[model samples]
Target chain A: MRLYLAYFKIKFLNEIQYKVAALAGIATQFAWGFMYIMLFTTFINNSDTNAISSSQIVTYIWLQQAFYMLFAFWSVDKDIFDSISSGNLAYELTKPVNLYDIWFIKTLALKVGKTVLRALPIFLICMLPFLGEFTMTAPVSIMAAVWFVITMFFSTILILSYIMIIYILTITAISPLGVKITFSLMGDFFSGGLIPIPLMPDIVQTILKYTPFYYIQNIPYNIYNGYISGNLEIIKIVGIQVFWIVILIALGKLLMKNSMKKVVIQGG
Target chain B: MIELKNITKTYRVRKRSAGMKNAFKTFFKKDYEVIKALDDISFEINEGEMVGYIGPNGAGKSTTIKIMAGILTPDSGQANISGLIPWKQRTKYVKDIGVVFGNRSGLWWDVPVDDSFELLKNIYKIPDDVYKQQKTKLVKLLDIGEIIKIPTRQLSLGQRMRCEIASAFLHKPKIVFLDEPTIGLDAVSKIAVREFIKKINKEDKTTIILTTHDTQDIEALTNRIILIGKGKILLDGKLSDLKKKFSKKYLTVEFNGDIDQLCDGLIFIEKYKGRIIIELNENILTLAKAIAFLTSKIEILDLEVDNTSVDDIVVKLYQEYGI
Candidate 1:
């Protein structure tokens, strides 16, 4: 655990070197959080809407932006694959450490540290104006906060599993230009990175629930919106999230083992 | 200790024809040609032997190094090092070996060289006392004490190469594989690297397997040479033996004053102010008859002869092997 935190802190210091970029990153998160506020506001004003109350919308947007740190995924593959193909892999391989874990966890720490450091502060800044609006029971608010944290944690695992699968596949495929372009496009529409799914097209909204993306954002978004309700609904969402996490991880392991066979053949 | 028996590796490489149309076609069709990288090669290095692994381009030098380093598995062979199969016991086996690829910089680009060393220490799980002591020794030997505190990105290639060698050795592994370690280095840097390598090999008896196109490196380091060509070990013996086996019938000729005549196998290879020197094959003509002819024809300045250096033999080997 000490080593893990050391790696995290080292990465944090590395990323903090770009102070202006870090500042801009936080500013961007809040600027975009306000856009979602306008969006949900436009939706709530459509009628005396109980589907999503105005305060719940604000809560949902706040969680979506605040705990956004939970869903970030990073992989060691991009660096590892490039180095392997370019003959630089020899250096890392000659070392005494597990090369895979070294890169994998370091990148994970980088993405998580950057996101939390950027996302939480901006989320709090954006939510500061609406603190006067909420008058909820402390226990209920605490439960909601705990559930949102759990949602973020499990969702991150699912997303990381997906990234791991892509990384393993990249060994055989070479040059993950296709994956990079796809992820860049995915960021534009899905994962609440750019826009919330509920306000998207009917087909997109339906697809989001099936994907791990919504758990990363929209599920937590729903929790704060109070759209999630009843003991049974909570059980189902949590159960499904856990199920996907297990399934994704198993699938990632299977691919990783299969890729190990190819690593023997291709020597990547 | 390292043992490799009949190790072989083959790589399937895509073959593309001329024209953008064919290149586009290969994107889908993917034509491939198999290349035999290592062909039934066998060798054993005892614990302390410093051997030079020499070859021409595409001669499987790097492949062999990678296999020994645990980064590659041979297609078919048995290789066991210190009771561990390299590719099978990768993590464990790699801990016992250090590799330096001359072309690549392993140091973090933006971080100080010492930071990279510290990271390496953590990576290898070296005890703090040993790490500090080794770092001090390496810094003193390589003369990179100042540069180690500076970011690697700002260092010159020679300085960075020094750091690279030091980094690989800090762990004090039993075996070190240096692939073209002296490549592109200046004369001073080359001598410094050679001296350091000699020191480590002598002081610690670390098994050093070096691959280089530079014959000077071979002469200065390994007395035993393993020559590979076309993915096969064609010759393995002492460097002097190789030279003796390749050359026969030395030539001696003394030219009177400066008379320029172009003749096959008669080389104007060496010259002095009062004399002209040439090596003529006694197999082609007797040295006594030639000397008699030369002395009778004109005034003889002076002439003596000696065997060619190791460089000429290597060039001849390449020509004969036609790699």
Candidate 2:
């Protein structure tokens, strides 16, 4: 655990060095937030189907933008991927640490560090009164806020385990491009990054619920906005999150073990 | 202690021909060619022995090092290092070993060298006092006290390399594998590295296995040489023995009179206005006999005798092995 913390600390410090990139990312996330809210406002206004309120949708979009770094599947650290492709992973293997845990913590640190840089400002701006009806609201209650925090933590780990599978696949893959693109696109669309689960077709939502993807951003953001309420419902949602986390982690570790067996470092 | 027997590794490299057509074809139907990287390689090294593992390109030198370091699993082999199989007991085995790949960095690039060392301390679970003492000793020995405080990216290659060696030693590993440690280093840096390696090997009794193309590194640091070529161990013996076996005496004579003829044992290499160079087959004629014969033929003013160089001996060995 201490070894992984050390790896995380170094990667966090390394990530926070890119101040200019962080600034650019913050700006891009805000632009994307406004664009998504504006596009969805028309649907909410015209549609009779009130799956979720307009205010909840506004909060959802804002939360998505604020924690974009944490939930986005495509935002993998390029350096880590390059290390695998370039055979610099050989250096990593020489260390007396589990390779999977090192990469997992490093990537977790990267996402958390990046989220720290961009989330606060987006939160403050989205909550401002100037945004009027589009402004992000606070949690429904203190209990809901607690559940949000708990579920978000589990959700992040669940998504990370899914991403770890992608990383393990990259070890045996001849090219990381196809694997990265295919997985990220599928992950992003299914995990409610492209469109919120409530707005999607019922059949799509039902199918997503069976997989781990539905529990990712869909559960936590909804709980925070009061879309998912009551102690019993929250407990059930959190239970499902924990279940998926265990399953995804087990699947990732199994894939990682198999891939590591045949892993060939590319260069001398 | 370390031992390897019949270690074999084969790589299936994707084969492709030139032109866009072949590239397209390979994308649809890939062809792989199996290369026998390590062919029945076997060797043993006792503690505190500095052995040089040398080979030409694609001769499986790095593969052997990786296997020993626990980063690679050979197809068929038995490697026992300190009563543990490297690949089977990876984490435990790696704790007792350190490896440095010259072309790639093991340090965190954006952080100070000291930070990387601290991370390593945690990774290896070294006690605070031991960590501090080791860090101080390594920083002093590598002369990177100031450099370690700066980010690794800002340091020069030589300075970074020194830090690299230090990072690898922070845990005081029992065995160190250095693959081309002095590569691209200037003379002074090379000597500093060589001296540091020698100092560590002597002081810690750490077994060092170095693979380098630079013969000077092997000559300066290690006495035992294990030469591998074409996936096979071509030579393994003391450096002095290989030197004596391949050594030839070259006699350069400065004379006033021109030599009309030469004996069977003396083969003329070059003829200048006042100097003549001849190679003496030591088996056939001794150096004293060559001088006697040369003096009798021409009035020798000055004569110099030189033996074959290490570089020539390596080239000769490579040629002999047909690698």
**Which ranges of candidate 1 are over 4 A from the true structure?**
A1-6, A47-49, A62-78, A130-140, A183-190, A198-210, A221-242, A264-268, B246-275, B280-307
TM-score of chain B, per candidate? 0.86, 0.95
- For B51-131, candidate 2 gives per-residue lDDT tens digits of 999988888899999889888889998989999998888888899899999989989888999899989999999999999
Cα shift from native, residue B30, model 1 (Å): 3.0
Q: What does candidate 2 score on TM?
A: 0.97
lDDT, model 2, position A59: 97
| Stretches of candidate 2 exceeding 4 Å from the true structure | B262-265, B283-302
Interface RMSD of each: 3.7, 1.0
lDDT of 1: 0.73
lDDT of each: 0.73, 0.90
| Local lDDT at B257 for model 1 | 58
Which CAPRI category fits model 2?
Answer: medium
Compose the digit string of candidate 1's lDDT tens values, residues A40-155: 77877786645556666666666655555445443233555576466576677677565445655666765676675676575556545445643111213566667766766676
Query: If chain B of candidate 1 is superposed on the true chain B, what is its TM-score?
Result: 0.86
What is the DockQ score, from 0 to 1, of model 2? 0.76
Predicted complex 1: DockQ: 0.43
Q: Report the first chain's TM-score for all candidates.
A: 0.76, 0.97
